[model samples]
Target: MSEKDTTNTSIEENVITLQTAQEWAARWRENPLNTVKAHLIPRVDINELLAEKYVVDIRAYIGVDDQGVNKLMLVGVDAAGNDLINASNGDYIYDFTQPCPNTCDVDSPLYTLKP
Candidate 1:
């Protein structure tokens, strides 16, 4: 499909925002399921979040509308936060693993990467 086709927001994305993703990222960070304990993956169902609600995974939400590099950065952090991707600050990091096919241009410092 063409890149323009991606602009069409899916029903799932309409229900979330960057803040929501960040909050979810925090929750994911606090949860024990993201890590290994007792030789098993902890139960994350207690989080009560859907696949789309996650900061990053097969689904992730960006801080901007449509597409842009800033979105990638935020989504990258969320991806990295979830340990699904690897990225750094001061650049537009790309992760082929992201389920979304959005790749936009971003040029600003406000788009901070998570340390």
Candidate 2:
């Protein structure tokens, strides 16, 4: 996947059309074995990562939990492509996102097929 330019990330630049968003969501939901539709990350956690020292971008990594469920591990990345979150500190990285299955907005087109 291509990375978005984070140098001057703006709300307008990040916003996607509804149809495009729905298409992406539908593709993910296409797989029968895919239980997790999407991850619901809180704005607070994102804000914290963005506010971190020398943080130029936030990177997301896939990880497996003890129960073998896939989860997203988020961290602040510097302009030098270095992870700003100290791995030595167990809680430095953010992984507080809740999966869409249990915490989804059912009315949204991303989660349901709207008529």
Candidate 3:
């Protein structure tokens, strides 16, 4: 298979749509990446964030860790929980030296308080 074909085994695996982001946020909301805490999360790819292109290694609903984040051993499962499919980028970790949250855009409510 071509590299592109090998890159994505799932049609929406690398997609970061609004809904996918929401689910990702909820999954990591309790514990976001904190460099001081030595927590490492997935690096947020600019292209993926803007939906311009699907960058390899940056998956849906991933947070960037400025620290050496733990490597993930990804495995895909079917709705019925059948045979497991190892992710294309298995056993990988994404980290950055610095990362910050931006809530300035109306689309993003990183710091928005709800009533």
Best candidate per TM-score, number? 2
Candidate 2 residue pairs that clash: none
C-alpha TM-scores of all predictions: 0.22, 0.60, 0.22
> Model 3: per-residue lDDT, tens digit, 7-95?
22333443323443344345455566542222222334232222322223333224422243322222223345432333353421122
lDDT (10s digit) by residue, model 1, range 1-115: 1233323444333233435446544554554443211111112311212232333443333232233212222232244555322223221222211222232112323223223
Candidate 3 segments exceeding 4 Å error: 1-13, 32-115
Residue pairs in candidate 3 whose N, alpha carbon or C atoms collide under 3 angstroms: none
Evaluate residue 85 in candidate 2 and report its C-alpha lDDT on the 0 to 100 scale.
51
* Residue-by-residue lDDT tens digits, candidate 2, 1-115: 1132344554333333334434444554454476666777767567866886788898765544545444566667889998765544322566556666677787888778666
Q: Give the local distance difference test score of model 2.
A: 0.58
| Global fold similarity of model 3 (TM-score) | 0.22
lDDT of each: 0.30, 0.58, 0.31
- Show where candidate 2 strays beyond 4 Å: 1-32, 88-91, 113-115
